[model samples]
Target: MKKISIILSAFVLLSSFTVLNTVWTNDDPHSQLGFTVTHLGVADVPGTFNDFDAKVTSSKPDFSDGVFELTAKVGSIDTRVEARDNHLKSADFFDAAKYPELNFKSTSLKKAGKNKYKLTGNLSLHGVTRPVTLNLEYRGSVENPMSKKQTAGFKVTGTIKRSDFNLGSGFPEPMISDEVRIEADGEFVK
Candidate 1:
């Protein structure tokens, strides 16, 4: 009976730890992953990856211990201009046929200020993986009236050099600026 009691106690403790973590998934239609790059050192062109998903897991109510993961389909790149979008997916750019996904998995989340955090993660794109840091703003959480679920909002912004990832290597800096600014606004539901 003593052995049974000890086993039960250990199981309860492990279960409680599991209960502390809440997993949140993207509210797909309400989320967007977009980017912008300067063209000809004069004009800024913006684009988006329409097919993407994000998952966040946290053990704290304030999300101070959040772990975020995201995956985006490279073929979903859209810049409004079909020709430009196609070119970006070809071998000259993302090479979507060879590397079909862009992925990010956070390694750390540090509080920078009230409702703001510095998120560092490994981003894999176009067959290259690199560590990147992004500014994360926690827009707070709310109870969704329609779904009756807890929803959390977040906006992440950052900039990465395309050359580091070997993206658009053939394009000169004058024609297509190497810097790419990334922004992702997402609503996640628990």
Candidate 2:
């Protein structure tokens, strides 16, 4: 009888945890995952990944305990300039044929301000994984009339040095900046 009571208690605890968390899938068509980098120290060249997936699960709307994961196909890079995009996919940069995807998984989310959060995560690019922190802004959540589903919006911004990932080697600062700025505007549905 004691064993049965213990088992029931354990099950209840686990079930409560599951009930508290909400899982949300990103709405791809409405999302934008893009980056910008300096070109020849003159102008900024903007680009985006055409294919990617992101999901977030949290116990609260603020996402203080959120678990976020994102995967982007390196080969789907688009800069609007075919030649430049192809070059970016070659050995000079992402080397999409060798390392097909760039990934990120959040380790922690800390509230910073009214709607801002600091998200720490592991970013894997070019076969190397490094710790990165992104500034996340929660835009708010709404109920969709069409599907009657709950949806949330967020914007994320971060920077990464290409050299840390062993990408775009030998490009001097005068030719290309090592720093890349990443941005994401995403909407997720529950």
Candidate 3:
């Protein structure tokens, strides 16, 4: 009897893990993140980057563990100024001439509340990679107005040190804060 009980326990544990990892993913036109970094200690500048692919898997109607991949085209650095935007794409900051994409990949994810999760991931920018934790909120699943497939979305926010990524070049701390806040709203399908 004890042997049978042990075997049943092991099977249940394995099944739990397996079910928790099942997921669905949706690509771009469904999610995006917009960013803003200060410039010359004078203005709160803004820019946007998009291209989203995220997977959602859960056990209790909430996300358990998932992965996300977003790639921002470096040359699309728009700040409303042609010359300044071009300069930003040059070697000093983004170095768009060389490395042309910023990526984020998840390493761990933990549930915080009923519809919130704390996600730990590595953000790669301009060749520098750093860990960032994003606080995410589930926007709930919905029936697509046109497509008939189920769509779910989440909002996530996090901050990172710019100096760690060689992004704060030519600016003093008093002028531009080293911390950059990233906000993203991403939707996925299951």
* Order by lDDT, highest first: 1, 2, 3
Regions of model 2 farther than 4 Å from truth: 1-19
Query: For residue 68, what is the lDDT in candidate 2?
Result: 92
When superposed on Cα atoms, how far off is each prediction in RMSD?
Answer: 1.9, 2.8, 4.9
Q: What tens-digit string does per-residue lDDT give for candidate 1 at 1-190? A: 9999999999998987775788999998999999999999999999999999899999888999999999999999999999999999999999999999999999999999999999999999999999999999999999999999999999999999999999998997989989999999999999
Q: Give the alpha-carbon lDDT of every model.
A: 0.96, 0.92, 0.75
Best model per lDDT: 1
If both were scored by TM-score, which would come out higher, candidate 2 or candidate 3?
Answer: 2
Candidate 1 wrongly placed segments (more than 4 Å)? 1-19
lDDT of 3 by residue, 1-190 (tens): 9999999999998987785454767646867677676656677876665443456665545555566555678887676788977877888778987888887778888888988888898888999888988898887888888888778888888778888999747865756778777788877776
**Which has the higher lDDT value, candidate number 2 or candidate number 3?**
2
Instruction: Indicate whether candidate 1 or candidate 2 has the larger lDDT.
Output: 1
Candidate 2: tens digits of C-alpha lDDT, residues 129-176: 999999999999999787798889999999999999998896768688
lDDT of 1 at 87: 93
lDDT at 44, model 2: 94
